[model samples]
Target: MASFPKSPFPKPPFDRQKPQDPPGRDADMDPRPDYGEASYKGSGRLADRKAIITGGDSGIGKAVALAFAREGADVLVSYYDEHEDARETCRLVEEAGRQAIAMPGDIKDPTHCRALAERAAEAFGRIDILVNNAAHQKTFESLEEISDAEWEVTFATNIHAMFYLTKAALPHMRAGASIINTTSVNADTPSPQLLAYATTKGAIQNFTGGLAQILAERDIRVNCVAPGPIWTPLIPSTMPMEKVKNFGAQVPMKRPGQPCELAPVYVMLASPESSYVSGATVAVTGGKPFI
Candidate 1:
């Protein structure tokens, strides 16, 4: 019955700036994202569940990690060497009275992806949810500006790694388990500047739909979350400064979404309440139509 007021939309325009690299830090961003640190009240929606989330150190992944912990689920936070961010996420998870495991490695490597699943299985005894949320992206003016290596790296990190992790985790997952992948709005409306990244997201949607059917008999669910321009470190680190300043203006809401806004959808998809919901793409795109 208790509720809180929602944050107003169309956030004040951000100042132009650039972040460090492919995977940026939450602490370094100007006006850090609201990852539901002081909010996100939970009521045991995923009690005692065990989940593995890639890119769980910051951004949407971190938000989901915190939400899951608050909802009574133990979480394994997989990240790409962002030790401080990962530690902070783990601390928050612990504060919620849930266990958190921080695993730092590149999911781009299939071997490392399998190792992540193994580590989660070893620590938790079983895997109830798997969120493939880590990604790589860069902006280019023209097709010629995108190199062969960049294209391959993008696919490896975005889509290939999801395949590897899913394959490794399927064996450990039981009926009623959930697999949530982080796709992008670009899957439906591709961004020319992000050719490689968008292509991989498109692949993720197709993969989610196909996998859901294959696992139907086992009662495992497969779904994806498609986000629009979210106020995450990845925006400044990958896009041009001008683009970063006006990140979410193109969306109907005229403001970028915070990572926290996307966490509840993940909670629902991973909850038993969504047992009948699979092979679906849930879009959290700030009032933007996903179809």
Candidate 2:
């Protein structure tokens, strides 16, 4: 278990909060996510590699996209609807001197997921990295309160889409390729209100483990990133305003992490620096304890 300080970040602005989607956004977030693009620079660690990232429009996905671009990876940014954020990410990718392709669609659809894989392959001539970062969550006070529809939607967007995308992309991925999934801290110590969402995350953990073993033969690594509370649009959109106000207070870091803090971990895992690392789950939870 990791340790976290029990303090909250200073509130940014309540009026600035808005719901963009299930995964939410940095644009309407109160304090807005820090992408750390200015500090990060590429040294050709992933030069010529092609990477596809879902939910790359905002939050952690956006941060990862920027870092990958900085590391010399041509990025394919996939998102649900947030065209504006997608555009911003694309601009940042170009600013980093890496190619970025914006693809907007619902990952919940198998066809869309397959098409995204095909598009990525077409864009870069090969698929080297796939980051399953898109997810959906809605609060429920009790397990009984979770509707079948909600559960289905959560699984469809979170786990099923990962399966679909991987199936499509794996055919094109050769040796040394990587697949990273974005799990959550809830998978270990779940929040009751996010039962459905947590369940899908747990499934993703197991999926990562199993797929790692299966792909080991081909030298294709599979892993997961489990994040704790960080200041992102998801908190304001899904939690009550009062809860949102105190978000990340339970963590050892006292304040929620900026997205920039999470970016380098992705870079490390995707780079040859961590060539021996795979079938692992790296936690960036502001010192939140996890089992």
Index of the highest-lDDT prediction: 1
Maximum-TM-score candidate = 1
lDDT of 1 by residue, 43-138 (tens): 999999999999999999999999999999999999999899999999999999999999999898899999999999999999999999999999
In model 2, what are the clashing residue pairs, if there are any?
3-287, 4-251, 4-252, 5-251, 5-252, 5-253
lDDT of 2 by residue, 175-216 (tens): 899899999999898888899999999999999999999999
For residue 206, give model 1's deviation from the true position in Å: 0.2
Give the least accurate 10-residue stretch of model 1, judged by summed lDDT.
9-18
RMSD (CA, Å), candidate 2 to true, equals 3.6
In candidate 2, which residue ranges exceed 4 Å CA deviation?
A: 1-21
